[model samples]
Target: MADKRYTTEFFLTAAEVNSQREMPLSRLVTTIIDTATAHANKLGIGFDRMISEGISWVLSRLTIDIAESPSVNRTYRMTTWIENVNRLFSDRNFEMTDAETGRIVIRAHSTWMAVNMSTRRPGDLTPIWKGFDMVDGAPSGIDNGGKLLPLSGSDFEMSYRFAVSDIDVNRHVTTRRYIDLITDLWPLETYDSMRISRFEVAFKHEARYGETATASRMAHAESPETATAQIAVADTPCCIARLHFSER
Candidate 1:
């Protein structure tokens, strides 16, 4: 049987690290998304091929759990595979491990949908399901079905202007950019003292370049270390995320 998994190795560079010398969560997310796309391209069903056929893949949801964060110059390996494909969505899983110690640093799950670019509607994925090598289980112990409940009210609010560089080939703000914007709301001191244990996000609408959007965050009432955030363009909600943190 053909191997259903694809693995890639990476060495964290100075550019990818934060002031604390550890890999930033936002940059790690970018690596994960890029690696997944590269693997799909190798399988002959990536963005370029799908866009040429008038369809494109859109990320709907993502969940990541981190056990440890690798520091600058640290080498790690990431393995990704398709867990399953349904009529509307597909589940992709990832595992990132420390190359030296073989310890799991992060595990993530994501849901994606195939959309008809012209009609701006979701396309049936059954026809292309055969092209993917689907595995039987998820690499991350957590499932991708968790929902991000709406925030009661925002503790902080700010405006964001989308730049040209923020847009992706799909003509919308990139997923990694959105995460960077959300995480930026917190002070650097928070990151210095607290580490994110779990993170979840749901993409609701597309934000185009040159658009001004508002971002808001609300801390959980019971768990002070947990918070939820939402980014919206005018009145239209673009994305929502929940973050869980632990003191270092």
Candidate 2:
């Protein structure tokens, strides 16, 4: 039997870090997705298996809470496991820890669905998940299936054209690119002033290459630490996200 959990190790490199030499939010989120993909593949329920059946994994929602962002050249470890699964959606959890000090760098939860390639509809998860082990009841900071907070009073807006490089194997805009686009709305000085501590996003629709999209964001009324943003194409929301910050 395969282990119910999976882990991988890596060090922050130039490619994953920003100008300040800290790992960017998008890179950290990419780590979460990468670990999930590797584990899913190990369980025989990942991309290769799903794609063969005319299905692909679609990220529905994700929430990442970071305690600290590892600096360049620092080794870290990431572990992930299946928390729960239903016919329509699966919940996965992850933890990132400093390899030297054993301190946690991040904890995240994600929701994914098996989508039919042609129909663009969610497919049943039961058939392939029949014998998979789920490590239910583990501590997860973010709950699956919660309502995504809407972006209100987003007075800032930027129009963008989806570039060819942003397209992925799914023939749609890569999710990571959307994250970078949203993060770009803030000036570099803002990132220097505040550190993103938590981020949550809900995927609503797909944006394709050559499509034009608008990114909008605003600070929440309650505190300077909170923010909300939305990405849309033709005025239809493609994805929405909220980021929580903490002063350095």
State the lDDT of candidate 2 residue by residue for 1-248, as single tens digits. 77788999998888779977888877877878888999888889889888778888888889888899678989999999888888888888898899999998888888898888888888877778776665565757654335766565576999999998999986889878999998998999988877888889899999999999989998877786777889999867899998888887
lDDT score, candidate 2? 0.84
Clashes of each: 0, 0
TM-score of each prediction: 0.93, 0.94
CA lDDT of every candidate: 0.84, 0.84
lDDT per residue (tens digit) for residues 143-183 in model 1: 55467765657999999999989998768898777888898
- Judge candidate 2 at residue 211 and give its lDDT: 96
Model 2 TM-score relative to the real fold: 0.94
